[model samples]
Target: GTDMGTARALRRNLEAGADSFPQDVVELMGYFQPAGDGQRIRAVPGEGEQVPIWILGSSLYGAQLAAMLGLPYAFASHFAPAELDHALEIYRSRFQPSKQLDKPYVMLGLNVFAAPSDAEARLLFTSLQQAFVNLRTGRPGRLPPPVEGYERDLDPMAKTMLGRALSCAVVGAPETVGQGIEAFVQRTGADELMVTAQIFDHAARVRSFEILADVHKSLSEAA
Candidate 1:
């Protein structure tokens, strides 16, 4: 559904006979550069009954627009870290209140993989890191088994960026990860946190989620 024309047509058809249907338009989250043809995107926000617009990005462009339009901003920090600081700074400085929010609201996406211990979490993270490396080298492939030497193999710059981005991620034992998440939320003041985990193994991914959920529960209890 990349076609705006098709979206408009669908909206018109859906509204034709519906009197009580929800008319609020939901624009799917997508990376949008502010300098790129933004007028078309601006047209999408007020299409039907002042639809809420969320500018999604891993960098500053999205934050700038979200602030300019007084809209919500969602950062794809889970996968990308470049320009993260610029994005947050721009969003906070330029934010203007709207009916939807009394002040600026920012949501950050994180990659979380919680397990029994740090060693286990590292084992799970091996394949995820490898996948990223493969993508960087243009050898995109399915997640592979966790190997022993990924930490040593990554370039210094890449390793540094990954560490910074994952600063908010939940890893290690449940108790340890719960503490990390609590500190992350406190530091970032993110209203919402979206998580994406990749462990190469589907069942292991599920287990990772389960462990994180339990950590959340533990944190709630502690709170």
Candidate 2:
């Protein structure tokens, strides 16, 4: 959630959330007492539910906080990957063991746009490219429909930014997607991968995941 405030205010809010998160969890698990009122509170259906909390981030702040709390960290590399390596290093090196987790666990975000043919997959990827460019150029709105040759129309700066931000994405046929997934995993050593796609057509979006699932099955069988 974007906080509408100054940097200091944002920091204060983050600190407050961090301090209260554990207490919230405890309250959800059963009992909590307000510091002021002499009353106990507990969530109705939430109490006694075993829920796991994972920290999601695209920067060092999230990594540091997750490490300090010994929670699993998920990097939003699908869109923002510039600080991924450094953030992972910091998290793993500084992790403190807690009751919930003992060792550092990392999940990486990846964009996969799979189709029957490479050209079709690339066409599907234009939607994401257009959306990203629109977002970076201060024209953020609902995701626009894909345009043919979207990158060709982009300015040099926009092109460069897109290349850098979407470097973690894989867009191609099954074979190409599989190879890209393998390369990304080998390079990052991520414990898990979170895949996302932003194809314009609903059927195409569904087909993309279907293709990815087949690719995953094939990879598993081969391994």
Candidate 3:
């Protein structure tokens, strides 16, 4: 749910019917403390060992808090990217060096669909396109099987919007995959990159990640 509609609202709604749902909401709140003392409690190290904590967000709020807390930051750019760069800038500039980390570390989330051929990769990518379109159209469900010419079906405006929203994504053959990852790294200088693929075909999905891993390894070696 959106930030405005937090666990409190869900808990309130569930109170009329089920008592257990409200308690579950309370437990969820303890685990998902975004602000206040509860958030600090989540950061506390247990026993003699140090605990590493990371703040996850697609907007500047998490970046600001992560900077203040001196924790690693992970941006959910794969879905929400409107504030990605701005959040990165805020995080790096306002970061306070902590005992656990000496400098700001940023991890960017990206989507990639890699295959032996560009056409094949694009066919695989249609699954994600369908899902995003479904979500935007208010009919989201388990990713339906890929539909050929799905982009053609969408009006020009949705196509443009999706292209912008998924700008961080990379979908292509081996050469294209290598170039895309290389360019992304050069552009963002991200400490780490997390790639996600939403493909309905299990075999194709595994191959997609395998291609990504091989491309990453080859790039690292050549570097």
Highest lDDT: which candidate?
A: 2
lDDT for 201 (candidate 3): 93
Best by TM-score: 2
Candidate-wise lDDT, in order = 0.73, 0.85, 0.81
Q: Model 1, stretches more than 4 Å misplaced? A: 1-51, 153-161, 164-168
For candidate 1, write residues 113-196 as lDDT tens digits: 878788888888878777776777789988889888787887998787677655556667777777777877887788888888
Off by over 4 Å in 2: 1-41
Stretches > 4 Å off in candidate 3: 1-48
lDDT of 2 by residue, 1-223 (tens): 2234435543554677756765544443333222324323333554445456688899998898789888899999999999999999999999999777999999999999999999999989999998888887789887778788888888899889999999999999999999999999999989999999998899999999999999999999999
State residue 38's C-alpha deviation in candidate 3, in Å: 17
Clashing pairs in 3: none
TM-scores for the candidates:
0.73, 0.83, 0.79
Superposed on all Cα atoms, the candidates' RMSDs to the truth, in angstroms, are 9.4, 6.1, 8.0
Clashes of 1: 0
- Minimum summed lDDT over a 10-residue window in model 3 is located at 38-47
